[model samples]
Target: MSKEILTTKDLHLYYGDKEALKGINLNFDAKGITALIGPSGCGKSTYLRTLNRMNDLIPNVTITGTIKFKGQDLYAPSADTVQIRKEIGMVFQQPNPFPFSIYDNVIYGLRIAGEKDKEKLDAVVEKSLRQAAVWDEVKDHLHESALALSGGQQQRVCIARVLAVSPEIILLDEPTSALDPVSSSQIETTLLNLRHDYTIITVTHNLQQASRIADRTAFFMNGELVEVDQTKNIFMNPAEKQTEDYISGRFG
Candidate 1:
């Protein structure tokens, strides 16, 4: 059995007076991809942010829950948010690469953390880009502006930036939604390759993408998890009628 790396219990989030997440309970295995699928405004993205305290950036955002990472309470008063984020890096929906050279973008986190070793940074940049499956495409253009790459390449570079920090977990929110089909497929392939080394959690609207890359699938509707199970089971034999309906296109 895969070891559990993250868990949430009775997680609730409120943006001012409106409840965004209602009593969520989920756990992620140490390695493999778990996809969160739901309609728009179903809180999948919001819940994803909560895992790394990304929601804390919003004003009037209130969270009440116990989120544990390797058995450590993530929201504990003494928990180091910076270290938590380093261990659990995030890639946003759009490819939001900084306007810097690809090499600089890959090593931005390390530089911020006071790493000034030229040789080490060079090695990390190459390794990270290789891991993100973009080294062959960008190895010769390391000093080129990241924005100069195609949309899909930029997303992969962003993924490399996260991997450069050697994070144990990667959170992706609609990572391929902005790309063309070919780019999206490339990103999916890269994610599949990364599953062996990192625990990946992603929020996506594409059911086909979830079936393609996710080992497990969680269906959310109206701020609650309708069902969660192995990808095959969720797609072929979901226990909840709501899940069945959504997957069958009976309702969204």
Candidate 2:
């Protein structure tokens, strides 16, 4: 693998002539947390989505420059979108579980990827659930409706769903924004464990959450990537004053 697991060079994104991300250059090391923090509409989520080509699903969205994973351009015409997405899974702000049982929810990704063997699916479900740290709570109730799960459990279920596909990088867009304090802590602990195996890139409006969980941090303002460095440096003594201002709650 390359020294940089993921890289974006001069990336510019436009949603029908409205520039959402300015020429942004970024790089991610292997199996570490990189948090994108900014105010609302600063393009934090937009920048995160572009990494895995999630923006491809939208209409009239144009992207420029190169986004590479392991030295291969992600936007090449011959690139496989489905395969790209599978390798770089995403969890959203809201925990949107499918209308199915807990067991089914974890296996949905495998099933869609054409894994039909019952033994393999079961193993994956168990491994992924364990990885997401929700297997024990819902193990006895695997057959119960996913909708019956509480907001936090449902979010972990979503995380398990993403893990089942064996993604190399996980993109989280405010994964804990909808949860309570306890639920937020649960997700944070889970993410810390996940960093051992998966490269995590998260976009969060909460500065404290970034401080707690991120290995490195990037700050964005008005669609421009302002500062990126170690989480401690970015928060404690930011190279840019804007980062200090944001974290200090002087201005968002």
Candidate 3:
């Protein structure tokens, strides 16, 4: 078995007075892909955001319990939000590239972190773009505005932006929902390649996509974790009736 790089224990969350997550406990393996799947409004995305403390941005949000990355409590008062975000990056549903050049977009995080070396920035741009599987397509067009690229290209650029920071984990929230079928396939392929270097935890509504890319699958419903198991088991022989029902399309 692989090492557990991250773990959540009795995690709970609330947005204002409504409970959003109900005691979620899950472990993420090092350099592996874990997919969170559920029906609409099931709190899977909420749980994903909590891993990197992204939920802190919401008003009247409260979190309890613990999220530990390599044995350190992520919600501790001394925990650094900026550092946590640097080590655990996120890619949202839409392809939101900055209005800057492709090269500049990739290096945006590094630049903000005060990396002033042009040679280093150039090297990271090439490496991150290659890791995102977009280097060959945009190598010669590095100076072109990222906003001018296709949606798929722009999403890949976003992924590259996250990768350039050398993060240990990448959180994806339905990253391909806005993309075309071909583009979605390409993004899936890129994610497969990325697992060799980064631990990935993604919230995906598409069961097929989750089965295709994840080593482990976690099912959530009504703000509670219903089942979690190996991908094959989760898809082929889920232990819970709820999981089977969801997978079989009886109900979401």
If both were scored by lDDT, which would come out higher, candidate 1 or candidate 3?
1
Report the lDDT of model 3 for residue 228: 95
Model 1 Cα lDDT, one tens digit per residue, 133-237: 999999998999999999999999999999999999999999999999999999999999999999999999899999999999999999998899999999999
Candidates ranked, most accurate by lDDT first? 1, 3, 2
Top-scoring candidate (lDDT): 1
Per-residue lDDT of candidate 2, residues 88-186 (tens digit): 999999999999999999999788778899998889889999999998999999989999999999999999999998999999999999999999999
| lDDT (10s digit) by residue, model 3, range 1-252 | 348889999999999889989999988889989999999999999999999999988889999999999888999999999999999999999999999999999999999999999999999999999999999999999999999999999999999999999999999999999999899999999999999889999989889999999999999999999999999999999999999999999997
Clashes of each: 0, 0, 0
Stretches > 4 Å off in candidate 1: none
lDDT of each: 0.96, 0.93, 0.95
Give TM per candidate. Answer: 0.98, 0.97, 0.98
Ranking by TM-score: 1, 3, 2
Task: Name the TM-score of candidate 3.
Answer: 0.98
RMSD of 1: 1.0
Cα RMSD to the true fold for all candidates: 1.0, 1.1, 1.1
